[model samples]
Target: MSHGPFQAQPTTKAALENVAGQLRQVLGLEKVDFFPVVKVLEFGLPSIFENFVFRVKEGPAMGDQHGLTFPDDSEIWLRDDVYEGVTQGKGRDRFTAAHEIGHLLLHSQRFLSRRMGDQPIRTNCDPEWQANCFGGCLLMPAILVKTCKYIDEVMDRFGVSRDAARHRTKQLNLSMQEVF
Candidate 1:
């Protein structure tokens, strides 16, 4: 649950709730719609909906684009064409939106806050990792992740992809050595 050098943070579930609160404050977002972002992109529903994205791009290719913030006017963008080409159904779409929200809440702060010793902080942390963590806790709470017997079981219940399910498993600190 705890991350960072000191493990000063609370569990990922608590952190996500905090993020959701902050999101409401910063973006005036009222709820976790999981559809608006996709609607904005104009992507249609595909039969197989994986709750995550698997990028063919080299390196870590998951989650959404970054650099959005609380005060900034920058909007989270999803071109309709791009969305249509990439993902499947509403579940997948919602997951992607939640993932982007993760980056905005988790990764954005490193860029916003000043570090001790005045050294420039780095974007070294994986945005995908943060987002996956957020999405897992948001989509499926820690209790479910802990109790679920298999990723496929989680996937069937949540209507998400196997990859998303696996990502959620790891993010929640669940054991995926068997399922994956």
Candidate 2:
């Protein structure tokens, strides 16, 4: 029995950490360093793009779709609302961009490989979940998350939203006993 489209493997914690570590090393980021989004997008993505052009397009209303990554052309499209949020320093927008980047890093190769064959492409695992997990890992690395005393600290240090920090704290099995 032949499996239909090549299902991309779900990323593990170790895999996420490895990727995060590589990104940190490439960017010269320390444990508590906040990711410089523009630098990462402009400089870091180029290293992965090879000959493909990496561009960010600010489009009209995307409704709930904050960002999208098209690996075929190495492009990321961000909704106007999302772009505004990024300029205003909203953490959700940052996470959304990072999530798109996550898709480029984690799914692009699998998508390319699937297209090479005659199989109808399908995802066995939820790509959104994988990308979301990757976004969390990338923005709030375990090294810093482990040292945080409160969710607010994670939010402040990583520039992540309260929800993101809370979820990450839960993932790390950290208690949210403090009032703050």
Q: Could you tell me every candidate's TM-score relative to the true structure?
A: 0.47, 0.79
Q: On a 0 to 1 TM-score scale, where does candidate 2 land against the true structure? A: 0.79
Tens-place lDDT per residue, model 1, 1-180, is 112331112234566656655543344433432324443223311111223232222222323432122213223444343345335554565566556555544553434332356443343333445565676555555554566787777776655667777777775677755454
lDDT of 2 at 99: 86
Q: How many backbone clashes does candidate 2 have?
A: 0
In candidate 2, stretches whose alpha carbon ends up further than 4 angstroms from where it belongs are 1-7, 52-63, 109-124, 178-180
lDDT of 1: 0.47
What ranges in model 1 sit over 4 Å off? 1-14, 17-71, 81-93, 106-128, 173-180
* Model 1: per-residue Cα lDDT at residue 170: 78
Compared with the true structure, what per-residue lDDT tens digits does model 2 show for residues 1-180? 013343566557667768867777776775644777656776777875775444545564455567777666677767777766766668999898788877777776544334356654443345666678778888988887888787788888898899999998888888864446
